[model samples]
Target: MKRFLVAPLVVALAAVTLAVLPGSPAAAALIDARVGALTFRPDAPGTGARRLASASVRQDLYLDRVSGTFVLDAEPVAGTTSYLRVTFGHLDAGRSCQGDLELRTDTTSPSNGFTRSGRTLRLVATERRFGYQDWDCAFAVLDLDTNGDASDGSVRSVLIGELTDVPARPVLAVTGVQLLDARALRLVRGVWTTIEVTVANRGRADAARVVLRGSGRGVQVRPTPVGVVRDDDDTTVQVRVRLTGKRATTLRLTASGGGATASRSVRVARAKAPARPRPGTYRSADGDTTFSVSGGKIRGFRVRTTTRCGGYPDIPTTTYNTYSFRTVGVPRNGIVVAKEKGRLYTARLQLRIAGGKVTQGRFSYAGPAACFAVERFTASRRR
Candidate 1:
């Protein structure tokens, strides 16, 4: 919020680029608009009529799920403004005059008009007739056909229409993902996260009708389905990717939409290493070892793994606790259980072979409990 109480030393209306708007069909495409925030024009200084010193314009578009409407957001780039005429949509009722986009704007001025420049200047409407800038001319464009144009006229700020020729998309980018196990990528069981897919208009021409698809074998969509809320939106879908079957080894995801295609992979398994060996539990980042026999002594050992990486910058990184074993062999057979505050966290089994290096795992937790796996696994082997 830019406050201009004590007249700004100078009053200047930062430049404004009134170009095309969002939710528009295929066309030459309008260059985004620029908001000149906190403009101070000394000559036309702050007053009851013109008091905007400078300001910025931020334009964003989104597809509304409830209203099935396209929403555009215009924010000041630098500072506050006295008035802003956002061009989002215009309709020519009965073709009486140049169609004017009915937009909702929070402005500083009560009197103003929407204008445009072309072969012949046209006046959409004066602010006097329509006190509120927002107009709902739903029936106006009912018969208007936008073969290659999505607007009623050359855009000054906003425009909207239907797409006649579906566009050709070139690239599908995986900007972000949620509910995926960090290391294996298999869907983390019982969790929901957001996944983002950014589809760039790659071809020489613009494309429309963009969609994103994700699926896998037995890899059920995790009871969480994903879809496109809007093309340029940062948050796309909330997905719950889960790998429930221990027998199933893999989960595959594919995204297709906007004339482009992409794929991602996730491997599922017991979320951690083995969990027993009471005083002899230990684990490594990666690699599955059969057994560790030190000096012909079969030291019973179980390895485990976990994660807690998602945290604020101020949060401390999770630390790995190690558990030392007595001898190089498997401890007594027992259900390797890990508990936190009386809550059953994970369970694993310890199995060692005679005259051979064989180790069987019991359990491994994947979240905060994962950090203490080794220390707990080693504690189970206390004689």
Candidate 2:
């Protein structure tokens, strides 16, 4: 098995186009929040609070996962301070929130209050509550929905001072993808292969509903769903893929969840061709039964029976007989049917051939009382 380490590549969050909502104050106009790099807000959204310092908002956001940390550096305001209110003007319909807003605060001077509505999240750091200013806060949007959907986007990050969207440090990363059988065996063309993907949760909080999917040219891979990855731990999931091409190809894999997404790509060599089975003589363990194969056809077959026939136990005086027959070309499934007839009896033979050998055969005889009723046997090629 060959494993490919996947560097955590930050997938850009889906771009959202925003138009200024009617009647909103000029300073608080709805704006597009494209967070991959650091975005600075120089002016506060409204009257009460000051804009956050440069690169103060760091956000890690996904379709259904979101989290971030913020430094709300501002002068003390006397009245009800509108510290931060996130306007999620980008979310689509049918998108609802789950998981309580987990906001960890570092300062006690100004008590914080969080509220969520249809598409807006408001964080209030009011002086009237605790008489504090200039604090640090971190939060994560635990679950976007009970079931994750790429069509929905949630709170990227909640900045306590200005209206900005950001994400937390990346959490779940696809550290490696292993071609389960690549090391010991070359992948055979048109054959299904199993691959294992490793995912690690590198953040403080647990990552939920992580799913991994793979893709490649002329190849097929099944998607794997990983429920959760606890903080600082890792897990592996197995997926089956089929290579259909003869030339080399690259397999791309992606792991996404918990407001984070990571991807990796691996190059796979051309698949090997199948080998044909050799033709030879095969015999049963007792040497009483034998089959001859040549040019993929059963050339000769024989079985000598000395046991019970139609419930007649073996005895010194029991009649013994040998039946022999020649068969035509073998079927694709390796089944052969032949018949032998005598003046007073008829014999039918059924044999299965596989892996250069004959196996699981049955012989049926119908005639006088001394005839053998049925016989079962197996045979392998002599090396």
Candidate 3:
């Protein structure tokens, strides 16, 4: 790490004579004094090329009735040396002095040239070293002493400062996208669907904000605004789209931030008309078995027996057993068939009905049981 040593002349240059001459005028007495220091480091390991750490220091000094302030600012310069600027405020008695400086590397002292314009002093060094490392740098500010004897003047006070820069470029990428609504699979014309797009920052810098844009032929798409995304972090935004064409369409979405952009696409097809089933409660001729059909599918069923079929055991002879079935295909000609397949058993059922009533049906089951059978029965629709 960079180190700074800021000490008053009275404490640092005690060997220098400050005594009054017996036959001459009295020497100026030491009064109030202050010292400060600063250090800067890279924000990240690989970011040193584009960014730097920042630091500053301030001090107040008083001599008798006079008071003054000193401020230091420091920062790293891209592809160049570190820069330091010092400002002097409310100098005592309005006194002005030129600043000379040296850059210290261990025991070796190298002169780092400086210039003073008005009350500000500036220094630049080719070695951009700071923080703890094998080698460190220190800056020393020097000036002529109050004593008329030039040979007696020596090091008096010191101060420190630092600066850092942030990465200049940002890289954005779209990592993944997903459709939020189940309707995305059956996208009908003139209907809207929700989609989620995830964005990530793959660069070394953070993005303060990201903007999303979406477009597609034969569809209107809108995207939600995404806020900040840090380096190596990701965020998701919502995109809503409505299909307006009769054919399949592709929707493209783009995420842009900090001069970087990424895009993703999704394909949607026009929906087909759903099969319509005769909707009503259906029952078998024995009245001990029943089925409910809705929206062109066998939605529910009940059976009375001692044997288990398709992982479902038959109900007691006094009661009916009920369970649900999944539709696997479109209904045809007022006939709806459904099936339930499991590791232990598989079942198939075909129901023929019309005018909101069941006319006839067949239910079959196959499993490890040797007595597996198919039963054909006639049904009557409930009034």
Candidate 4:
């Protein structure tokens, strides 16, 4: 949709007399104005008679006895389109003025449908069409004989008004509720499962201010009162719940708004804990290094390396460095944390494994005389 702002030019008028005034003597002191009951009736000839649907209008203006201006704005309702006309009555009393206005986003000067007779002004902004549903128009009335400065006129009356098309009533339905991860359907006790609830609006008009709610035994739902669901649209509400009981359980979720409601359920079963990796040797992609785990604990690392020294064999020589690690925390979330110590250095390592394989590992070491090194490796279990 196109969006534009319409601001009316201020009118400064030199005093002039008029035979008829719009409202009353009090109209001169009026500083505010408003439009009431702005409505639109589809003028399309032939598709069964339809009720007049109300369209929203918003206006901003400065008014007084001698001069004023107003900007009216609105967006046409979705679906049907017809001639949308706006009429203002008893506006800016005791002033003789003219208006130049345009509808939609047309850049040319507005040439038709703006007229003032007695106390009322009427304008047919545009014929509503597809992709041209939004409109903003400015209306200004100035005293007849201002010598070019708008602020010189006596303060008259100001009118700001808005017309909004009411969206059709909404019908809410709970489309589905499923675990974010299919594997999480069988939930383990003491663990959290993430699920999503799909809410759909099956109505022609937009739905406003919908609230979603969920309930179940032995479960805690985070983020209650899910936000709104629009018309002919669907929104997913994410819920994270921790199951405390071991047996099977069901979760019920409901979406309610605009005098309509829907509900759905998800069933979860108690499952055994995931199995830990077997304690064995795992070799890196390169054959020069290997890691070993025993009794669910990471124990040792062996690396083949070449070093250069002046007094060794008078050249670079190959050597083997083997370091033993002391296992620390029990495995959790597929990770094992441990510490390795050597005569002159100490190191901390974290190893991550999944599906019976050591996917990656890292270690950091510090030694005397400020020696330090950090390394990472990826490995798989030996066949």
**Local distance difference test scores for all models:** 0.31, 0.50, 0.46, 0.46
Model 4 off-target regions past 4 Å? 1-167, 180-184, 276-383
lDDT of 1: 0.31
Instruction: State the weakest 10-residue window (summed lDDT) of model 1.
Output: 59-68
Off by more than 4 A, model 3: 1-168, 180-186, 273-383
Q: Give the top-scoring candidate (TM-score).
A: 2
Ten-residue stretch with the least lDDT total in model 2: 1-10
Q: Which residue pairs come into collision in candidate 2?
A: 59-166, 59-167, 60-167, 60-168, 65-259, 67-167, 67-168, 68-168, 109-132
Best by lDDT: 2
Candidate 4: how many backbone clashes? 19
Tell me the tens digit of each residue's lDDT in model 1 across 140-176. 1111122313233311222222111122234445554
Instruction: State the lDDT of candidate 4 residue by residue for 197-293, as single tens digits.
Output: 6789876445566777767887656655656677779986656666788688887777877777788777867766566767778887876557676
- lDDT (tens digit, per residue) of candidate 3 on 1-383: 11122223213222323222387536523212222233322112122211223223222121111111222232223332222323222211212112222222111111233443322333433322211111111223322232222134333223322111222355788777654213243355675655557889876567766888878888887766777778778996656666788888887878876767878777777765333555678776677667666665565576554344343364322223333355433334444445678988777666555565555566666556433556666676674
Ordered from best to worst TM-score, the candidate numbers read 2, 4, 3, 1
In the order shown, what is each candidate's alpha-carbon RMSD?
Answer: 19.0, 20.4, 20.9, 17.5
The residue-by-residue lDDT of candidate 2 on 17-65, one tens digit each, is 2223488555522222223222422111322123332222222222232
